[model samples]
Target: MKSRYILAALLATATVMPVASFAQQSAPAPAAANPASQIPAADKQAIQNFNLTDDVFNRIVKVSQEAKAQGIKPKDAKTDFSKIHSLDDLAKQVTDSDPRIAPLIKKYGFTPREFLLANLAVTNAAIASEAKGNPRMAAYVDQSKVNQKNVAFYEAHKGQINALMNEEPDPAAK
Candidate 1:
């Protein structure tokens, strides 16, 4: 999978872990039974306007890893894996579902909303940096508005982030 898709999948799995597990333990259901919620206007703006701060970026990364370590698994066969429009959808679902994952986000000092925004911002910046000279990918994500500092941070931390992404999902998450 592309790195972008991998990152997105990782985030989605983390957010859906608790809910998916519950749904599985309860009864069998259609995969797409749970539809994605509409993202509020305020959240849409927050996601668009967000510029990643180093602290927020660090917290997001740390909280993601901690969540996995604490047994929050990625998408399993039981997961709906429904298509979501943006990080806003993931954030709303995670926060609204009252999942255990929400507390981990808060433990790192980010509301689910804030963490999603930072996630999008940092992901965008990283994608933009990689797309700088590549025409096809560049056309997909706007490279101009990405924060330079965020891009620089992504460049500096690229190895660490890649390593994390490539790590096997913690079995305890099951």
Candidate 2:
């Protein structure tokens, strides 16, 4: 029962964290009227390389939308995602604490860390590109630098991360 609460809280945190961070920064410009053209080529390639399938990415967007509708806030205002060194840190903490999370993440073909890292990379790239024309969005450009570093870290350790995820018992095996 306690674990369920923890999982809920973590999921909630995951949903709201980015929104809260963006809120602290300036409001983003309206997205390009054409959605398909919005993602830059480099960002698209990064998403593909990370294997963040449409289903996985859509689910993440859905969670963010829900969080916004509910006006959720971060559990801790001081939590700075820029400081996260690697996806491994996120994956281990979440999966180790709640076995249930591992399977859900696996369903999306991601470790928890991979999911977060990929999403952050894609999001930051889009925001940074948009910020390029707007002086007010300078902070997003800085945030994007942090995200790019983390994504590079993930790419460097991709094989090891996949091996670690594979070591976990498949949910179906149970």
Clashes of each: 0, 0
- Model 1 misplaced regions, further than 4 Å: 1-45, 76-89, 96-98, 170-174
Off by over 4 Å in 2: 1-56, 59-85, 129-133, 139-174
lDDT of each: 0.56, 0.43
TM-score of 2: 0.36
lDDT of 2 by residue, 1-174 (tens): 011122234444343333233334445544342222333444434433454344655555444333333333234323334433334544455555545556655654666766565555444434444465688765434543334544444455446433432332223432
Residue pairs with colliding backbones in model 1 are: none
lDDT of 1 by residue, 11-117 (tens): 54443322222122334454455432333445445544676666776776777677666655444323333645455556665555437667777888977667766
- What residue pairs clash in candidate 2, if any at all? none
Candidate 1: residue 127 Cα off by (Å):
1.6
**What TM-score would every model get versus the actual structure?**
0.63, 0.36
TM-score of 1: 0.63
